[model samples]
Target: MKALLPTGDPREPVVLADVPEPTPRPDEALVKVEAFSVNRGETFKLEAPAPGDRPGKDVAGLVVQPAADGSGPNGIARVVGHPMAGGWAEYAAVPTDALAVLPDGVSALQAAALPLAGLTALRLLRTAGPVLGRRVLLTGASGGVGHYVTELAAAAGAEVTAVTRDAERGARLIELGAAAVVHDLADAPGPYDLVLESTGGPSLATALAKTARRGTLIWFGQASRRPATLDFFAFFDGPESAVIRHFHYLDADTSLGDDLAALVRLTAGGRLHPEIGRIADWADTATVLTDLRERRIRGKAVLTLA
Candidate 1:
């Protein structure tokens, strides 16, 4: 089997090389990866990768071998999975609990896009509580997770305000159900009941300031690769009842398989859209990683196994 590995070189950080096929445990299924998605966070680890560190999280494929424990999908089922690592390969050993059977009408490309970004958006909205008739602020609203957040939040009856520097992306966000689109954080209307913030740096402080009284701000990512410093005294004039919470998708209490299955069902039903920005053969994994690191691609980038 062939897998993408980190080369530890500044110019060429990743290379596709032949590797041994993975063996599944009793609680795991051996998947023949039809497609996979790359994420921004995964690209950061390639900067200084450890020995034998496999870089991939979102995997979608057919279960060639089911788990011996009789959990998850049965033999030869189409499924999407969230493995801790090593999903950028022709074959992956995915734990049954992390695997979700995909329904008809869901393509592998769409399924591949769902695991990480979809799960993060779903979990963040869950953390945001009921959003009906609420003013929701979404920062960095052009990427994969942001797309899902905008669509799902709007479907739940929340008035979504999407903030993105890209005018084209801003236009698409409105089509995806955002009530309003702003090019800058300063331009976004304040007093938001819930703020889903991912861009770090100064945007974090701005998002914090925009949170309404007794509202919630969920900080999920630092895509800007910069640190955010908040003026302690600034909060004195801000809403004292507002809450700021750091969130990671893995911290959610629900079953991973269940959450993924729900996302797949929504996609199958055409209620949820998995915005795939780029698609290419698995041989071009390095190029895809470069595009993701350089921020040339929007939404999710999916790689297919030829």
Candidate 2:
């Protein structure tokens, strides 16, 4: 099977190569991958190795063979989490418990883009508390996770305000259900019940300031490549409250199948829609990684196995 491997060198870590096919264990299913998407973690792993590791996490495909334990449903599965070693490949073996059946009306490419970003958005929204009739703010509203967050919040009856630097993308944000869109945090009206912060650095502080009193602020990503630092005094003295929380999609109690099921349902019912940036052949994995690293693409970039 052909796979993309990380070489541990920042400049040239991701490369396409022929690798041995994965063997499914008793509790795992062997999926003939149809599509997979890239995430920031994958890009970071390639740029800087944490001890020993490979990239690629999200996967959507058809199950060629079910686990010996028969854990998957109807012999079809969507795998996520654990950053399996062969996502950018022709086939991958994933735990049957970690797989979910793709929803009706959702394409393989779209299903591949949902696992990571959708789960993260769901978790963040849950952390933000009840959204009924509340105002929510979303930074990086044009990114993969942001789009899901925007739609979910709106569907929950929250008035969503999306922040984006690009006016063109801002329109798309509003179309996704945001009540309003702004070029920056400064331009957005404040006192939001919840703030979904995706970009770090200055945007984190900006999000904190706009949060309503006792509001929750969930910081999920640092796409700016800078650490978040805020003044404690300002945070404590402000009328709007703040809570900084990180969204880790792979927590021990998080069931991949359950999350994927929820996402699949939403997509199947037309409640959640993923905005895919580009779709390329699996062999072009390196090019996709490069585009992600350089921030040249928006939404999700997926690779479909030919």
Best by lDDT: 1
TM per prediction = 0.98, 0.92
What is the C-alpha lDDT profile of model 2 across 42-107, one tens digit per residue? 777677666535456788888888888867754554444223566777778877666777645888
Clash count, predicted structure 2: 2
The TM-score between candidate 2 and the true structure equals 0.92
1-70: candidate 1 lDDT, tens digit per residue: 9998998875677898999999888999999999999998888889999998988889999999999999
CA-RMSD of model 1: 1.0
For residue 188, give model 1's deviation from the true position in Å. Answer: 0.9
Highest TM-score among the candidates is held by which one? Answer: 1
Candidate 1 contains a number of clashing pairs equal to: 0
